[model samples]
Structures are given as structure tokens and as C-alpha cells.
Target chain A: MITFKNVTKEYPPKTHALAGVSFRIEAGEFVSITGQSGSGKSTVAKMIFAEEMPTSGHIHIGDWDISNIRHSDIPVLRRQIGVVFQDFKLLPKKTAFENVAFALEVAGESTKRIREVVPHVLKIVGLGEKGGRYPRQLSGGEQQRVSIARALVHRPKIIVADEPTGNLDAITAREIIELFTRINDFGTTVVLVTHDRDIVNGLHRRVITLRDGKVSSDAEKGKYLLS
Target chain B: MRSFFRIIRFALQSMMRNFWLSFVTVSVFVLTLVTVNAVIVLNVLANASVKSVEGRVQVTVYFTSDASESTVKNVQSYLLGLSQVKDVSYVTADEALAQFKENHQNDPVILASLDEVDGNPLGQALKIRAYNAGDFPFVLQALETPEYKPFIKDKNYNNYESALRVLSDFSEKVRLGFLILALFFGFIATLIVFNTIRVAIYVHRDEIGIMKLVGANDWFVRGPFLFESICYAFIATVVMGVLLSAFLTFANPAIVAFFQGVDVDLVSYYLTNALPMFGAQFGILALLGLGTTTFAMRRYLRV
Candidate 1:
């Protein structure tokens, strides 16, 4: 349920982060946007979340145009799409439970709803037993799971994981990829942006490859096609 | 309403988690109030002492011995007519001599000199009190009229002028010095508060960024820090009030004894204006904290 038509984003002094890109995904489609570093893959995820605006062209998530979204309206858009960063951006002081509950709390959810939903979501990401632990006390995989749990807390229709497995060990990375697959099987649209080839070939879903600020390929049931 | 309570709860939890920083912020606030209250107490003591000295100042006007008692009484009446002259007393030559003897009774040289004068060398004198120490010069000028100056031998205005000048100058200098001290301490307090909030924002920068990513509005992120600052201000004010009350209770007796006869009742002054005074302090400090928090957040709090 997201569309980027003829989208071009440029930085100052002739730096093109993204150029002449067009993509569309129907509701409940899992898509992988893959490329080498600086190939504008992360820029796609940033556009979906309205962190970076398209310099030219149109972007529509369902019927809402976010090509030039207002700063005030960004929060409402963000609530509908959960974002998972590579570094597991959890508040260091907050416990695992508080960290997950924070997303609902920020949305003005009632204490009763927050109490009911936070544990359930954390349990979905397999962090229910370690809810009392802080980020420092948890391992990298556990911390990443906490991030995934936070992203799922609001039941956002689309989950955008930007390099979600970048810091984890190989086995842990595989587990996180499988977790994304599980999330996708539940009919939530998942856009995984990464450079990891094994994860991309393993998924065998819709893959959009970018090279030098342009989309080089888009293939259904695609393999890791980049050198 | 629930979000408002949540913000307050988050502020308290943050305060407890960063207890040392909170303690430092509150202590700086208390120290600033200490400087302010010290200035207030010193101002009160200086004013009372200056007024006591001013009350004792009187100008003595000596009339020639040949001047009649009626003439001296007439001069006294004229001096009393001036608004500058608060009171005037006419001392006959005999009374002046008796006062001189009583004052110099401990000094034989003064007694021998008085006896050698043969018949009350002292003349009738007018002791003039002015409403203000600064008005003595005006009062002395008023006495130089032809009718009054012909009978007058001398006026001891010079002695009171130098003393009043010193007292006035000292009082003004003390007040100026204290004001400068207050300003210096106030600047330090501002910087300390600015840095404290900056560090707090730095520590929570990640959380702040993530909160925005997770759909929090700007006020949602800002409210907790603002409340945290107010919490520090509130606690600091309560601590300062307790300390000041305890100090006045323990030190009031010593202060009274030190001034001896001068009226220095700090307890009554503080007790009377305690609410408005400390309340103003808390307001000022809380505003400072809030202002600094807002500024410090400008760079870090994007949401």
C-alpha cells in the first residue's frame, strides 16, 4: 500500500541520493530493497518514514501523499509504520518492558491498554521473560529483538527494518531474518532494507536492487543479483 | 489528563535515575537563594545601623555670652519654624556650664579650665535636630540670617557633616558591593543550570530520537524535561526555606546581642514576608531552569 512515482532526492551541490525511482507495493506484500553502501537503499526506508523528503516527484502511502509531508503530520504517519534501526535504538535507562510500552505511551494510550499490550507484543518477539532487563543487560540479539518488539507494539500496518541485522552474529542474523518472514506471513507489509546477500537470497521474495542512485532491477521471486 | 500525569511520573523517574545530576541542580538553586537572602539580611542590618547613627546627630549653636536669654529663645523659635529643624532646645549659659562640668568630671584638666574661666565662659547654645542627616547643611545655612548670626559665636556643623558623609558613603558602598556579588553569583547559577540540562539532554538523546521515530509529538518529549526542572526548583525552594528558618531560630539571639541596643529583628521580618519572598525565589529559579532547559533542548530535541 505504498507508492513512490518518479521520486528523486538530491542533497546540496549536485549530490543525488536517489534519482528517477518508481515502485509500488500492494497491501500485505513483503519487499526487500537491497543495494551496496551509498546505493540509496536506506534513503528508500527514510522516505517511507518521512525522515527525508523527496526533492521531486510524488510519494503516496495508500491515499495519503507524503512527498512533501508537513513536519507536524510526520508523527501521525510514523505511528502507522513501525521502524527498526540497525543499532537497536532503545533507551538505555528504560527496562525492556518500559521501552516497549514507551511507543504506546507516546501515542497517549491508556495505562490499562499499555499494560495489556506491551507484554503481549514483547512476548511475540520472545522478550516477555526479560522484560525487566535494561538494554545493557541484554545481548545484541536480545536487544535487537527488543527493538523488533517495540516496532510491533503499535501494530503498524507496515514494518520497515533498516539494516536490522547489521550488528548481530550470523546465526542471530538468520534468526532475525526468519522473524521478519514470520511477521510478513501474518499479512503485515514488511520492507527490509539491507546489503546482506544471504538474507536476500534466503527470502526469495520481491527484491528491488539499486546501483549509483538508480533502481537497477526489480524482480519477483528474486535472488541476490548484485555482485 | 492521563498523559499529563504520565509526564509528571516520567519526570520523577528520570530524576531518581539521574539522582546526582538532580542533586547538583537543586544545590546550585539553593546556593543562589542563599546569596540572595544574605543580601536581604545585610540590607536590613545596614539600614537599622544607619538610622541609629542618624538619630544621634545634632548640631550645637553657641551664642555670645552677652546675648540675652530672650534673644536665644527668639532664635530657637525661628529655627523651629523651618521644616528642616525637627526640634530645638535652648540651653542657658548656667545650664551649659553645669552640663560641661558633669561631662568632664572624670578629667581634671577640663574641670581646671572651666574653673579658670571665672564666670561661665560657656554661652547659651541651641541644639538643632534635622529631619535628615543630609539636611544639616541646609539647616545651618538657614541659621546665618542677620538677626541670628550676630548673636551666634560658632556652630559645630563640621563635626556632624564628616560623620554623616562617612555613614552615607559606607552604607551605599556596602549595598553596591552586595548587589555586584548577587549578580556574579546569579550568572554562575545560570551557567551551571544550562550545562546541567545540556548534559541531561545529551544522556537522553537516543531516547529522544527514538521517541520521535515512534510517533511522539514535540511536547511529549519536552514535557518531562520541563517538569524535571520544576521538580528541582521546587525541592530546592523547600530546602532553602527550612534552612533559613532554622538559621534564624538559632542565630536570632546572637544577632540581637551583637547589635546590643540597635533593633535587628530578622525573625520578624522573615516571618512576616516568608510566603511572598520565598515564593518569588522559587518562581525565579523555576523560570531560569525552564528557560535553560528549553534552550538546551533546541539542538537535541527534534520531536
Candidate 2:
């Protein structure tokens, strides 16, 4: 349920981050957006999160025009979409459980709801045993799983992982991809943004490749071709 | 009610988590409140003492000793008839001479000089008390009238007028000084509160940002800070009240003995008689604390 209709994003001084890009991600779809550095993959994810508004096009997320979302309403939009960053931006002071619970708390979830939903999401990401551990205490994969658990707390309609495994080892990156696959199987729309060709090739899902700020190829069950 | 307790519990936990910062904030607020309360208390005491002094002072008019007793009696009757006069007492020249001797008993030279004066030169004097300290001018106006000029003693007027002028000037100075002190302390108190809140804001910056992200309304975020400020001021006010009461309790007897001949007792008079007035002062201070804290936190909490 994500649509970017002819979105053209231009930075100042003739720098076009995304030029005339059009794409639609249906609900329950698992998709990978692949582009090399400066190819605007991250910009696409940021637009979906309303972190950056498109310069000249409409963005619709499930019937909501998020293009003009006010700063105050950003948090509300964020609750509807689960976001995972490569750096795993978890508060270091909190345990894995607290980090996930914080998302629910910020959403004003009841204590009962938080207690019930937090452990369930943590278990879904295979972090059930690491709930009590702090971010530093967990492995990189485990930490990313905690971030995934946080994203799932509100049963968000879309899960956008922007280069989530960029800093992890290949094995850990594959493990994170597997977790995302499992989450996508449960009916949540998953959009994975990455530049790693090996990982993109392994995921035989829809691939949208960007080249010089334009969509170069949109193919079902695609391969990474960046020449 | 449960939500309120939750908010308070969260605040206390955060405050305890940052104990050193909270203590600093509380101490600052207390210091400011103490100065403000001290000024208020001093103002109250000064006003009370002025009223007491005003109640004791009267205008005394001396008659010419060579004048007939009938003329002196007429003057006394005339003073009694005036609406401004509360009471009048006539002291004959013989009695006045005896009182003068008794007053100068410690000074033999003064006593001998007074005794050597021919035939008790002191005249019959009428001491007149007025309804209010301000009404003294009205009585003076009556005495200076042309009708009463024949019986007036110019020297008596000259002596008593200077005393009256000095008393009036002292009361006005005391009043002006009290007001200035109160205003100065009030401004300092407000600044102290403002700085204290700013420091607390710096310490809890993260919590505040997180609280805002969690959909907390502006009031919910402000409530705890407001509560903290009031707590500091209220505790200081109570402590100052107790210490002041104890001080007045133990020192009252000495004060009463010192001013025994005066019309009012300073300490006991306030403790027993002006308790309600003191309570009002406390209430005003509590409100001042609230107001100052609220004002200080305004810019810091605008988010």
C-alpha cells in the first residue's frame, strides 16, 4: 500500500537525488530496492518514512497523503510504519526488552498491551531469550533483531529496513534477511533497501534497481545488474 | 487519581535518578523563597510596631500658668467637644511640677533647677488622644484657630510640633523602606526560581524530549516540575514559620519588658492576635512560589 507517483526529489545546486521515479508497493509484498552509493535508494526509504518530502510528486501510504505531514504528526505516521536502520538506533541504556517497550510506550500503549505485545514481537524476531540483555550485551544480529522487534510493536502495515545489515557480517546479514522474510510471510509489506548484490541475488523477490537517480529496472524475481 | 499518582511516581523516580540535580534545584528555590518570606515577615512586624507607636503618642497642650483656671477649664472642655479627640486628661501645674521632679530624680541638677523656678512655673496642660495618628493634624488645626489663640502658649506648640514632625517622618521612612525591601526580595526570589528551573531543565532534557515523543500533553509534562517547585517553597515557608514563631516565643518577654510603658506588646500581640494575618502572609508566599516557578519554566518548556 505504498505509492510514489512520478516523485522527483532534487537537492539544491542541480543535485537530483531521485528524478521522476514512480513505483507502487502492494500490501503483503516483499520487495528489494537496490542501488549503489549516491543512487538514491536511501532517499526512497526516507520518503516512505516521511523523513523527506518529495520535491514534486504525490506519496500515498494507505490512503494518507504523507507528502505534507506536519512535524508534530510525524510520530503518528511513524507508528504506522516499522523502520529499521543499519546502525540499530536503540537507546544504549535500555535492555532489549526496554528498547522494544519504549516504542509501545511512546505510542501510549497500556501496560497490559505493552506487556502482552512486546514479548510476542521479540519472540517473532527470535529475540525471546535475549530480552533481558542490553544492546551492548547482544551480538550484532541480535541487536538488529531487537530493532525488528521494536518495529513490529504496533503491527505496522509496512516494514522498511534501510540498509539494515550494512554493518553486519555476511552470515549475520543473511540471518537478518531471513528474519525479514519470516516477517514478510506473516503479511506485512517489507521493503528492503540495500546495495549488496549477493543478498539481492539471493532474494528472488521483486527488485527495483536505481541508476543515476532513476529506476533502471523493475523486474519480478530479478537479479542484481549494476554495470 | 490513579493517573495522577502514576505521573507523580514517575516524576519521583526520575528525580531520584537525578538526585544531585534535584537537590540543587530545590535548594535554589528554597533560598529564593526564604528571602521573599523574610521580607514579608519584616514588613508585617514593621507595620505592627508603627501602629503600636502611633497608638501611644498624643498631642500635649500647655496653658499659661498666669492665666485663670476658668480659661484652662474652658480649653479642656473645648478639646473634649471636638470629634477628632478620643480622650483628654488635664494635669494641673502643681502635679506637672511634681511629675517633672520625679522624672528628673536621677539627675540632681535638673531636679534642683526645677525646684528653684519661681512658684512652679509649669502650667496646666491638656493631653489629647486622637481617633487616629493622622487625626493629630485636625486637633492641631483646632488649637491654632483664632478663637483659641488667646489661651495658646507659643512655646508649647514649638516644642511639640517638632516631636510630631520627627515621629511622622520616621513612620514614613519605615513604610517606604519596608516596601522597597519587599520589592527587592521579590525580584531576587523570582530570579532564583527561574535559574533553578533552567538548571532542572538542562538535567532532564532527555526525559523531556522522550516524554514529548510519547504523546504527553503539555500540562502533563509541566505538572511534575510545578509540583517540585511548590514543594520546595512550601517546605521552606513552614520552616521559616516555625523558626519565627519559636524566636518570638522565647524573645517576647524581653521585648515586652523593654517596651513595657508603650501601648502594645510586639511578639505576644502578633502570636495571639494576628495569627490569621500571618496565615494570609503564608498563603501569599505559596502563591508567589507557584507563580515564579511557572514563569521561569515558560520558555524552557515551550516544546
Per-prediction RMSD in angstroms?
A: 3.5, 5.1
lDDT of 1 at A43: 92
lDDT of 1 by residue, A1-227 (tens): 89989999999999999999998988898899999999999999999998889999899987679986787888888999999989999988789999999999988999999989988988888888999999999999999999999999889999999999999998999999888889988988999999999999989899999998898999998878888
Model 2, B101-217: lDDT tens digits are 887889999878877877777888888887776777778888876766776674232234455566556756765675666666666666766776677777667656544533444
- TM-score of the second chain, each candidate in turn, equals 0.84, 0.69
lDDT tens digits, residue span B55-101, model 1:
77889999998899999999889889998889998888888889888
TM-score for all predictions? 0.85, 0.77
How much of the true contact map at the interface does candidate 2 reproduce, as a fraction?
A: 0.13
